[model samples]
Target: MTEPSSTPHATAPGASASSQTAASQSAADETPASQADFRASARRTFAIEEAAIAALESHLDDDFDRACQLMLATKGRVIVTGMGKSGHVASKIAATLASTGTPAFFVHPGEASHGDLGMITPADVVLALSNSGETAEVTALLPLLKRMGTPLVSMTGKPGSTLARDAEAHLDTSVAQEACPLNLAPTASTTAALVMGDALAVALLEARGFTAEEFALSHPGGSLGRRLLLRVQDVMHHGDALPRVALGSPLRDALLEITRQGMGFTCVIDDDDHLVGVYTDGDLRRTLDQHGDLRALKVDDVMTRGGKTVRASMLAAEAVRIMEENRISVLVVCDEDEHPIGAIHMHGLLASGVI
Candidate 1:
């Protein structure tokens, strides 16, 4: 009939529009279900990895101690080496160890076979990582490491693997299941390895008695470094910026000094220029309440004696602690002889990032 219409009847203008609209509605309906599947998948992955890390706690044993002792006693750095995803985890472990007072650095196993092996010395302890323990690049280095007399520490999912057997210490980072739905990805295994690395770093850190100051020295560019290294003298107001008034100076003069220096307080000094007392905004209010005239009072009459003071050489963080303990905002910096040298306000510590 009519040579059979070239276009299918469903492709007619009105039918085509309706069909496209139906397709759009169908896609819109599937979107929420797709999003729900994605979220459920993420939750399952997190749960599996969390369990993997928790399970590692029971695996910590004598080998873990030996690993730490070997690293601690090494005359040289800890050379961390791994391949593939394990290599990424190894690199991070090296960084964490280095920052926490353990000297360490990462070397790729593939590169090690290509002359990077020279980076490892007999004095250094080699920490090798391979989830499979049979990673060709990593297992290839075992004989070389042994020949060099380098002590080897291996982290692997299989305790009986070649890398583990050859290592002086083996850390089992095996997980019960892979977080990947296909059971092919390194998700849970890598998490276990990372947590084990952190455990080693922290154990070594404690054994070495690594103080916050020591940690800060390794991280001089971070906030902890600023808090540990910044001295009171570095942020204190010195010379003319110091608010000081003589012991017998009028209360009015002391208030003027405080306002002039904008330090909220003024140091009342003796004739010898040693700090004798402190007159603050708190003193002014108290004086107004107890006295008839502010001008008639002397700074010594309202000054608080034996006010808290810090040495100029003290850490700004320590100064913050003192201010916090006393519930005050300002502190006068003094010399060894208790002579007022400078003054610090809470704002100074805040600006210096010491608080």
Candidate 2:
């Protein structure tokens, strides 16, 4: 009180400088991590998961063969079941198995207990997944499946767990550690199960002699299916759309036919209506370079003999291969007698989605 100062209750300018510095440091710390840091984290996960898959090679045993034989002998579909993260992987495995000649589908363990168990039968085989081999939801189905007399194949981390002990075949998928920094989340474990599922699918596919055509039958709505199943006859122009000119006809007639059909070429046929040659854009270029007159040329003189051809039964993908290999844009679909029955051009192949 004796010395009331000029700046009473006011802070000295430098007294709280440490606090200002701390605020600045906090703002800088709030900035998001750099991409490099994130990438390093992801790379570590990849390495961990890769090592988990590699470890699977050494763990292979006779149980793998037993599992395959049980599924192969099943008279009904393979019912795949799991819980939580394992359930998601089981769904994909079922899809892969079904697409690769093994009849299979996914049934959630929880749902299976709630009347979905009816989907399973004694003739079917069950493949179950549980990283701990002690998931209550999945384990609960054990007795019911056994009562149904259905064989069980299990993939689990614990070899001595109840599920593993009850299974006809048990695949050990334990990893030394998880990709998770905390080692609590499902990371490497899921990858191991997925890889093991893929192994089973491919093995069954090879054992069953599954062919591409049969695989295409299951996947008939996409470009993959079109490439394998779409045929030349499905995409080629035939009947009244055929562009043809008899051999020895005026070259202008072939040109007009090519222009009318819009396929860039016209078939040159003989009196027997058998394809003898073709007049194409390439032939047109040669003719223009060889002769100046427009009306005096015969179709036979300008036509390329024995033009590239495909059968109506040939796959559109095979047609694409032939076109790419020969550097041609069109192919005549012919009968056994070499009669031009249809025409397929690059545009048609593109439109069919088989190219």
lDDT for every model?
0.92, 0.93
Candidate 1 on 242-310: residue-level lDDT in tens? 999998988889988989989889998998989999988998888889988777888888899979999
RMSD of 2: 5.6
Residue 16 of candidate 2: its Cα lDDT? 74
lDDT of 2 by residue, 214-268 (tens): 9999999878989999999999999989999999898889999989988889999
Cα-based RMSD of candidate 1: 5.2
Candidate 1 segments exceeding 4 Å error: 1-26, 32-39, 285-298
